[model samples]
Target: MNIVVILAPFSLALALIGLAAFWWTLRNDQYEDPQGDASRILIEDPEDRPL
Candidate 1:
C-alpha cells in the first residue's frame, strides 16, 4: 500500500520522460531512412578493410 504511493509518481515520471524523448525524435526527423539504414549496414566499405 505504502509502496504504491512512492512507485506511482516514479512510474509516471519515467513514462513521461520516454514520451518526451519519442516526441523529440519525431520533431528531429530521426525516424527517416529506416530501410536505407538497414541496407547500408550490409555494405562493406574499402576503408573498413584490413590494412
Candidate 2:
C-alpha cells in the first residue's frame, strides 16, 4: 500500500533521530552521575530550611 511506503521512511527517520540523540548523550557523559541523582533526592539543601 502507498501508506506503507510513506510510513516506513518516517518511522526509520524517527529511529535514526533517537539513536543520534542517545549517541550524543554518550559522548557528552550525560549518564556519568546515574547514582548521584538518585541519592541526591535523599539529601536536603541547607537553603531550603525554615528560618
Candidate 3:
C-alpha cells in the first residue's frame, strides 16, 4: 500500500538510529564490565552499622 512507502523509510531510519546508539555505547565502553556490578553486591558495606 501507499502507507508502506511512507512508513518503511521512517522505520528504517529508526532502526539505523538504534543501531548507531548501540554501536556508540559499545565503542564508549558502556558495557565493558557486565559482571562487575553483580560481584559488588556480594561485598558488604562497612557503613551499614546500626545508626
Ranking by lDDT: 1, 2, 3
Model 1 C-alpha lDDT per residue in residues 1-25, reported as the tens digit of each score: 9999999999999999999999999
lDDT of 2 by residue, 2-46 (tens): 999999999999999999999999999999998998998788999
Candidate 1 TM-score versus the reference: 0.82
| Model 1: CA > 4 A from native | 48-51
Instruction: Itemize residue pairs with steric clashes in candidate 3.
Output: none
Candidate 1 lDDT for residue 17? 100
What lDDT would candidate 1 get against the real structure?
Answer: 0.96
Better of 1 and 3 by lDDT: 1
TM-score of each: 0.82, 0.82, 0.73
Instruction: Summarize candidate 3's per-residue lDDT along 1-51 as a digit string, tens digits.
Output: 999999999999999999999999999999888799788778788885456
Better by lDDT, candidate 3 or 2:
2
lDDT of each: 0.96, 0.95, 0.91
Decide which is better by TM-score, 2 or 3: 2
Q: Which ten residues in a row have the lowest lDDT in candidate 2?
A: 41-50
